[model samples]
Target: MIIVALDPPQNVDVEKWIKIRYDELKEYVQGFKIGVPAIIRVGLEGLSKIFKDYSGLLIADLKLADIGDVMALTASIVGDYGFNAVIAHAFVGYSQAVDELSKTCEKKGLKLILVVSMSHRGSEEFIDKHLESFVEIAKRVGSWGLVAPATRPLIIKRVRELIGSEVKILSPGIGVQGAEPGTAICYGADYEIVGRAITHSENVKQSALKIIENQKQRVAKCRG
Candidate 1:
């Protein structure tokens, strides 16, 4: 799925911006992703008003790393508003409390995607240090997916090997972040989290379409 990260234009009417972007790009992409910062900027009430008519998967990138109750409550708010999934942090060691959060997410029916590694510079060492334990948390929590950085193809490959096919892998860092579009999927990603690559392009619809085309071309090349 091509998830368009919903970012509110700081100077414009955020509700209008969202509507325009979604309406324009929905046909080319599968879903939309709104991070915690964006949600906070517009508030859930504002977000609900704008997304009520959206038919695709709505992902809330909570990336929560707090205690269990806080995570549960945050997820309650996200699920209540109709988000299909939410991302969480698994860097902390597993325990009964985290298991409780897992139960809460399952009860809410929101898919839990754990962030394994980030895209920007300087995150490698930290993620590498904690990678093994994070995978353990992911397995214990019944996570639906895992976040892998497209910028690092081997990391995706390693994650695919370690976690296998049961866990869906979502990758970011395509286009503007310098990772080639579709290449992540070649390595092991199931979806690419594209943002500025499309959003900042001169033409949003065309940019979105090109992302899909790029992926398809990659697939064709691999098969050939």
Candidate 2:
């Protein structure tokens, strides 16, 4: 499964890239990641419109990190807004944040993917040391799965071992980061996230097709 991050486009003319991508290749990717930039730029009305048009999964990568009540409320709002999943920071409020968000999402029957490790050089130090703590929290909170950078496949495997198979892994490090989506799946990624690789490609549909093909190859290899 590929969750393409439909980040804000550079030029005003490129602003319609999310709708265009969704229109062109919704079948290739499992869902579309609607982050802060897209919501801010397109607004709720625009987002609702997009959701109506695109009949695929929607992940609101809002990275909610605040008090438990506030975080839960925000997550509930996103779920009510028709997002299939929402992103929350693991280290923000830890168990409290996860617990509240998980409860609300479960009540609404939505998935909550925790941001265990982000795809940036700046996040190395803390994630390196406190990974176990995050895993422990994940176990306690009863989340649907976790979202980590696919760049660290070994770490993802380790985290999965600690948490168990029931907790799915959503990884993002393909395309722009040069990590092959198939390799990530082979390393235990249930859902591979490819951002700029498909969304920013000269041909969005082709880029998405390549990723879906990669996913199929990986599944075949695993079966073999």
In candidate 1, stretches whose alpha carbon ends up further than 4 angstroms from where it belongs are none
Task: Please state the error at residue 199 of candidate 2 in Å.
Answer: 1.0
Model 2: CA > 4 A from native:
13-15, 53-55
lDDT of residue 68 for candidate 2: 82
Question: Which candidate number has the best TM-score?
Answer: 1
Tens-digit lDDT string for candidate 2 (1-224):
78788886666643476677778877666788888977888876677777775666688888888878888888778777778888888887565667888898888878888877776776687865677787787777887778877787787777777778888888888878867767667877788888888887899898788788877897788768
| Per-prediction TM-score | 0.94, 0.92
Local accuracy of candidate 1 as per-residue lDDT tens digits, 1-224: 57788766567776777777888898778778998768888788888877888787788998888878888888888889878788887875567445666888899988888888888777676876677678778988888988889999888888888888989889889888898878888898888889878876778888888888988898678657
Candidate 2 residue 48 C-alpha distance from true site, Å: 1.2
Clashes of each: 0, 0
Q: What residue pairs are clashing in model 1?
A: none
Give lDDT per model, in order.
Answer: 0.82, 0.78
